[model samples]
Target: MSDSSPLPPVRLHPEAELARDALSTPLLSRAARLARWAGPDTRVDAGGGLVDEQLPAAAELLGLTGDAAAAHAAEAWRVAVDTGLVEVTDEEAGTVAAGEDLPLLTGGSPHDILAVWLAALEAVLADATVPDLDDLAEAMDESGEIDFSRLDWDPESEAAFLDGVLGNLYLLTVTEDGPGDGPVPLPALAASMIVPGDLGEPTNDMLEQISDAMMRLDDQFRLLEPIGLVAYQPVDEALMGDPEEEPAAPLDETDVSRYGMVRLTPLGLYGLRARLLEAGFGAPAVGDLVDKGADALLDGSSGYGPLAARAETQQWLDRREPLAAARELLAAARGSDEGAPLRRLRCQQALSLVGAQAEPAVRDVLDDPELGGLARVWLSELGAADVPPPSADLVYWLTIDTLAAQLAAEGNSEELQTLLEGLAQQHSGFFAAAWRVGHPATADVLEAMGRLHPDKRIAKEARKAAFKARSQQGG
Candidate 1:
């Protein structure tokens, strides 16, 4: 149907609306009933407005096997207690007994179940309430890679939520699974989960739109950037409106959400549902999602710090904007030339945020080797361009001394290689470090470096170390 096709009316109340407002206006209802029942807040005797008598069949509806269903119900009950989304009171006589399952009914079809999950997630996100990690895991696992074809949502809504859930779940899982070194970075996890086929049979245009939206999400929220790299919930200010105030629906017709939103306009829902019915839309391959994420990050944010700069840069990159982050950094640095070292540092940082792309400019700042140690070091770490190998032999000797001392603790040949590779691509000096470590005295020594390099060079040197290790083992 055309975008302006006649729509079904909003059907909140069949009683009053029968004679009033145009009945043709399509009404998109929610899946809260199903979500409430299936969510962690539902227990056998309490929460989710469920009665004890409903337990047995509810378990069956959930498709839980035997005692597993009971267990699931109980866990939901416990979750209810913990999150305070619901409450349980002692029975004063025979009003209701503990351990009894409430009879809950839902018009929820498969798509409805999916819709409910998306709605819940959106609620939690908007409220900044962290989702119950375990509950989501169960849902995703049970759903098993997800097939929107069988789901009950409008096609657009389905695609939007699928993308959103994938993004969020990927981030949450990564945070928990990541090495406990720093604030959980969604990018790393997003990078891992995103791979081919994750978009199912998405068209190139759809992918581009999603990419652009993700980049925007990244710029607004750094922690969420990597997740955006895969999936995202684009805020439809018109649809979602201001949570604290305003009517239940949006007033603006022009405003549309790029990412999936729990609430959708009639047209949006219509489009989504229609797409769901259309053939070819399938489960996106995890590998493809990951690759997309990696490509975005690699090309988007070169390398600065605070991590937020990368996030912002990613936004522009996603749009395929001509003003790439590298040029942006250069402009910033050139503008701040007369400022304090702090300003220079900030500009450098901005450049660094652009990563390897800004290396040349970074190297240009180090004409005076005496004051360039720190700058050169940063360039080296990021694999930036070089400053002509320190023209003076004495300076070269000092540079080598400093480098050797700094790297004295032993290094992974492969990890060093990767690190130097980034730099070597820009400045040949970093490659030297990788080469030096590649020929370390022994396999065990190189292995030790791979295992213990404190500077995070292991990723860079791991391969070279492996090669050297095999060579040594053979000899």
Candidate 2:
């Protein structure tokens, strides 16, 4: 697939796209490069894929490490196979590289490779056998020296039980965290598998069974870790039965989430996104614009919250010339919409980013009573021709609106406090007069200022102004 592959119908928040750019794309690129370096026949015998042999070379290329513990060759191979940059084929006895595998000689789109990786994950799961789980479970049982209860799920075939672990692993891994950055703790992952989702509370027996199963299920990691699909950081070994060693206590839910915070690797994040979308969960895109017009971009952004709106709008603005952006923004502000006042306010703020060239269009709006306050402020900020002072109510509304814009745009608490101090200095009875300002947002703006101001005295004054405005409205 190419970048032209249709994404989910709904546009997601910008953060989702940003995470992939910052994490996933880079990981895929590195994996592609590493795979090519490892060559076409990158064969892996039952002895863990011959990954260790290539570690020094791959590590040098990726800048990870060539040394035994630091080597990430295993992880590189996992990424390569998952991303389809490197192909792993079945041999008569073990796994071998497919002869026709084409290396991703150049960088491919993250979205394209992510789809391939996800398809592969589903394919492997659909075809995986019970023997796969049994081989891992046997190894885990030998290490289970701690007290644990076997699960009541008695399957005549251990294969079914093994498959359950894999299913539980996949489900738990997907639900664990967002843009999951850390590896998950095996105990926590195992406990989630045992915890009945329908039960309001599980019994103590279930908890014990889950704990033991989690330890036994450590075999999941034992199998997956070698392929570099997962990794672990053991906190401490249970120094049980040794008088000199402190006794290790059973892990509780709090200890489980606290001690071992498992995160997915970038590769895992890529694969899991596919799983999430398949489950009908909405995956976010950073800057998928529904419309490119200034109004559409500005209006479209409001639903995404402040940071996203700013990011979304800035991205839209960056693509167009400043003069064009200013004109479109001004026209969007003049739309016959339900939220005209708010739109006008937002438009003026966006114009500031377009700079002085926007002054003439902004000046033309000064005659409109609703936008008069904002236009005057825009002119002043640009140091244009001298403008007569606005009326006291207009002044009150304009100052409050300006502060509100700052609160939304700049978010400077100190600047807000300073503005309040200036109002106090300029007008001895600022709050008393502010209570009766003639703008629609007067009360709301004052109320927000009061609620958000850090200074107790200023916040009190703002609250007083808001109360008076409310009383006036009621009367």
Candidate 3:
């Protein structure tokens, strides 16, 4: 008998560090019980998500009821999936089993349950809740053009879409609820989702967007909260006014508006960040940059989105003594090769933060070619030296480096294949040359593309470049 099975994921897991706090222990235990009750071969209906068959049992087990009982039931089932208790699958596909190796919850240790959930969570996240998140993450590698209009609203990508909506919620939260911060009001979170406040005052249109966002939130929470990805106070049906029967035909409406507050559970954060990190995106918080050297700091910040990079850059600078920071900045800038000019400029910006103390280093580098223009500009800004016209190559290198950083940080292989192909179209010969360039992480990044790309030809090309780089280094 011949049994053909696909290989397990290699690079994505083992790097995932699941966090189990006091609150998560019980949820994880319940999740384990849910999985155990379902058995190892729980079968989902053929044409839908795993929630269909398990909701009632899950809802009852979780002691959930009310107008939101079904949602809670679905969420608990999802938690069982996310926490490694229940695996989502089609009974007919035989590709996956809804109950693969899941143990019954009777006296199951928290550590063991958490361990199982961690492994399953990585797999689920690897196969993103948002199916086209591959393309979406790739789009972020550049101007981050999100064609929200094209998002698949089907159950498959609903979770991933929810993750994006959550991001908008997260941005609204940072000031008040920075990483590891607590919950914000549901109204505020939903409002932020509709109008990020980017365009000044909110308008009526935003209300519609908020309502839409809430509907989506309701859908997500029904499946997510029971499993514990989110914790919130469900909408109080009692708050609404009694139905007004008028002389005219009455309007029938079901108020699905959600309220109270919601935030990612510790487990949710770990799972999402793991997906981002695996795809080469920057998911680190500001604290990760504290105490790092200027070069390392800039390198780390390079992959972060504009807002986070700026915040992280400030935090990095704030931690250092001015004179010492300036010296380190200049040293880092001087070390930047043509391969990474943006890093040099970022270092220069950090130097400027050091005030007049940075003047001496600027003076010392004034005679150097690659850095002289920047040096003179910093000095000139302070009325100490003449500013030279900016160097063309410096600007060019910066542009390319910026693109490379974004590409490496966020572009998945499909995007990588296109980006590399586009670069090849522009440069006379690029794939071969890319490995030689000073862009940090190029070789490793290319290797990741090689492994994940959908097209064999592009995958082979990426592999070739990675090999060439390694060979050149060894030589």
Candidate 4:
């Protein structure tokens, strides 16, 4: 037997190297800068007060238009408040104007942050153990408004949500993460906020509308994580690929109550302590806490959500497991019997689970007559998306053979006729099958072929087929 193997899988982004190299292009560099800056809300501690005018200035520095910039900052604060990341007070806003340095929020790369939230929802679904997830609705409203009074954001559920987000964040950071240094600028931040697979990129006008909604949410909820008090750190290189590395930071020490009055009670300091311990940091000795400024800068940058939800859950096998799954499914199929319909159906289902990995194995099974029909159909569907279109000669040959087989099959002549008619209409050259020599014709297929002949061999084949029809009729 001849031996050959299917080609290796195609990666869609073959231009990755070129894409990376082009990051230095002026437009992208500007995008990267903006992504860093627009990532966090501006906050300052005015003694016990809050200062926010610099919010507009910071927005301007990020090159935002007056109305657009004001709105962007509002949205940043809104995502923070909604996700339980921060709290703000007008008192602290004054402090921000006075230039007092304050603690920043738990921060990391934007992609990591976004991944945590998305994966949190994904993890909730996966953990529920459902096969298909199309039925689930989002946590927010149909009007895109978050009614904080309505949500039951209990500590346990919030913690679970946080855990899901953090786990997912870890996965994105370690596996498919990208790079951006310095604070992301506003435009890039706004652009990235337009989630992938969303209808279209958000325009400045859309950003303004989003900002307005955030302002409304802020008025209703109050910004818990005050501006100037928290800033986002640049994504470190260490978080890029090492799944096992301990996070190079710790959670902030501010009490959840310090952020705002919310629908649910914030997890207390003790809970934060337990979380830190779970994150692999040893609790500080009693004396150590005193000197570290009665305050701890929360590791606003934890990697928990993405890691657990995405990396651990999907757990893509490096090379062998998919092939192994296919082999196991196939073995189970073969032990049943050659001609059994149940066995045939099992093999088909198994091959589908094996997906592209089972292509070769299923093709081999095509040699067995019992498996041929099922295998050919699988191969056609799976292979259609992969293989280039067939040439006219191959199409012509297959069309004739398939038509002949349908003619010989006893029970479905009308269905077969419909199939042939559809094929002739869809593919211009299949008219020969519709009018096949002695079958039916207005003039003749040979004359039609002669009139349309672009290639000498095709015309000859048409003429020969006509003669063969006459011979079969005992002409």
Best by TM-score: 2
**Model 1, residue 168: displacement in angstroms?**
23
Per residue, candidate 2 scores C-alpha lDDT tens digits across 31-132 of 556555654545565643454565566666777743542334555455566546555555444454522223213243545434544544443333232233
lDDT tens readout by residue for model 4, 151-226:
4345455344434332322222223232211222222332333334365766677777544433222232222112
Residue ranges of candidate 3 with Cα displaced over 4 Å: 1-18, 22-27, 34-161, 173-182, 192-206, 215-219, 236-238, 243-259, 277-281, 285-294, 302-330, 335-475
Number of clashes in model 4?
Answer: 64
How high is the CA lDDT of each candidate model?
0.36, 0.55, 0.55, 0.36
Steric clash pairs (candidate 2): 14-286, 44-49, 182-262, 182-263, 183-262, 183-263, 184-262, 184-263
Give the runs in model 1 whose Cα sits over 4 Å from its true position: 1-53, 60-68, 89-364, 370-389, 393-398, 401-475
Superposed by TM-score, candidate 1 places the C-alpha of residue 110 at a distance from the truth, in angstroms, of 22
Candidate 1 CA-lDDT value: 0.36
Comparing candidate 1 with candidate 3, which one achieves the higher TM-score? Answer: 3
In candidate 1, what are the lDDT values of residues 294-337, reduced to their tens digit?
23333222222224333443443444423254444433333211
- What is the lDDT for 29 in model 3? 54
For all candidates, what are the clash counts?
A: 59, 8, 5, 64
